[model samples]
Target: RVRFRDPAGATRTGEWTDAIECDGRSYDPAAVEVLPPCEPTKVVCVGRNYVAHADERGADVPDRPLLFLKPPNAVAGHGATVTLPTGVAGNRIEHEVELGAVVGERCRDVDPAEATGVLAGYTVVNDLSNRDDQRRETNWVRGKAFDGAAPMGPVLATPEEVPDDATVECRVDGEIRQRASREQMVFSVPELVSEVSRFLTLEPGDVIATGTPEGVGPVKDGDRLELTVDGVGTLQHTVRA
Candidate 1:
């Protein structure tokens, strides 16, 4: 099932019947325009949520979740092109596909068991990065806070439809780059929700990026990205100047 939030601020939920309709024509899911299901107040991300991913990048594992934020202006639709800024020279951009959680209700200091209840649904997220810039500054904001860096969607899937333990995989040009079950997460969805809620109040439409697995690398102009979560759907996009 595909759940989408219309531009009018109303929610429109639909199933993948024959094809997705837009502008009076049918197109593949990847070709459709998308919108953020929620006008998020903040985009919270968990760093090193996956063990292998942390080790691959030569980063130490954290005892607790590591958090960061991406500005709201950085968000864009799934099919949107992410422009590389001229100011950041010699920077390599990487793609990190994550399973994003959408909060349904206001919550703070929520318990793990109750975390799942607060989730409105799930969506695909591509956390783009400037690796060289990141290493140079040792700060993530400049590396990740680029316009169109977070290309998310096709639509959202309610928890009732997509189980909490879905499989997430990311492919580039039809080659599998990252694969893992939700069960493999060092921190489960509910646990992450509970942990983040303790520090800040999660309001309706707020998003939490659960984190990406290993196999993350760089993508160049003209490269294609295909991110899929079983039972949810696939989101495809191309890199461009």
Candidate 2:
């Protein structure tokens, strides 16, 4: 599904195929301003859910999922230009391509076997990071939860559309920076969802970001980033210094 601004400046949600279909009229996707497919109350992110990513940071992967939170204010839509914090010297802002799971309802203590039943769909999320602040702060609130920190959407695909081992990747200015299969995640989507629900009730529209693979790096001003998740489609955004 796609959420976009219609020609009349109204926000609309529609099914996306060769074109966007809504109310019996097809729309050229490029002609409309794409919005974040869902308005997440909170974005729960997994850290080091990939072995190679943990190795890159020289940190030990936890037996259980390592999690972080990015509040609603951090959410940004496709085609948005995210501003990097430049107050600190040597600030290293980076892009982390991730697959996002949108919750379908409010629930707690979900069983892994039944996790899929609570999912609305899947979408692409760029977990924007301020490495300089992240390395210093324990909670990473300043590092990960800044305004427009999570660039998401363009499409939300149902569970049936995405394969179990779909590819997720990030390209900066047309260069492939990160690429891996969803199967590479140390914790699967269902496992992550179940674990998170065990800690807090996941309300509908909340998103679970399943973590990034290796090759995460910086994005400078004027850089165009394309984050893609197989079956969901690509999320494009730019960075501003």
Candidate 3:
């Protein structure tokens, strides 16, 4: 599913195929302003879920999933430009590509085997971070949950549409920065869902970013980022200095 604003200055949501069809009108995708596929109240993110990513950060792999939260204000849609915080000296913002799962219903203490049943679909996410603030704080709120920190969407594909071992990649200014398969994850999607629900109730539209792969790096001003998850779609956004 996709959400966009038509040329007529009206908002519309519909299936995205060759074009966007809404109210008997066929609108060109390029002609409309695309919005995030879902309005997630909070984004539950898994940290160090990829072994190589953990190693690169000089942290040991956790025995269990490390979780964090991103409030709604941090959500940004595809094609949006993310502005880096400049007030703080030595603020280095980096990008981490992740596969985001949109919750389909409200549930808690879900079984791992039935996790997919509560999922609305999947989309691409860029877990932008401020390395300086992250290293200084324990909660990482300023580092990970800044405004427009999570640039997601372009489209949301149903669970059946995505593969069990889909590929996720991030390209910066047309150069490949991170690339890996879901198979490399230390915890599977179902396991992460089950584990997360154990702590809090997941409501409809909540997102779970299932961690990022290795090769994460810094982004300069005016850098274009393309975050892609196989079977979903690519999320394109740019960074402002």
Itemize residue pairs with steric clashes in candidate 3: none
lDDT at residue 160 of model 3 (Cα atoms): 92
Q: Is candidate 1 or candidate 3 better by lDDT?
A: 3
TM-scores of the models, in the given order? 0.87, 0.97, 0.97
State in Å the error of residue 15, model 2: 1.7
Ranking by TM-score: 2, 3, 1
lDDT of 2 at 221: 88
What is the lDDT, from 0 to 100, of the residue 166 in candidate 3?
95
Candidate 3 lDDT, 149-237, residue by residue in tens: 99999898999999988999999999999999999999999999999999999999999999999999999899999999999989999
Q: What global local distance difference test value does model 2 have?
A: 0.93
Angstrom error at residue 187, model 1: 0.9
Model 2: residues >4 Å from true position, as ranges? none
User: Which pairs of residues collide in model 1?
Assistant: none
Number of clashes recorded per candidate: 0, 0, 0
Q: Rate the local accuracy (lDDT) of all candidates.
A: 0.79, 0.93, 0.93
Model 2: how far residue 6 lies from native, Å: 0.9
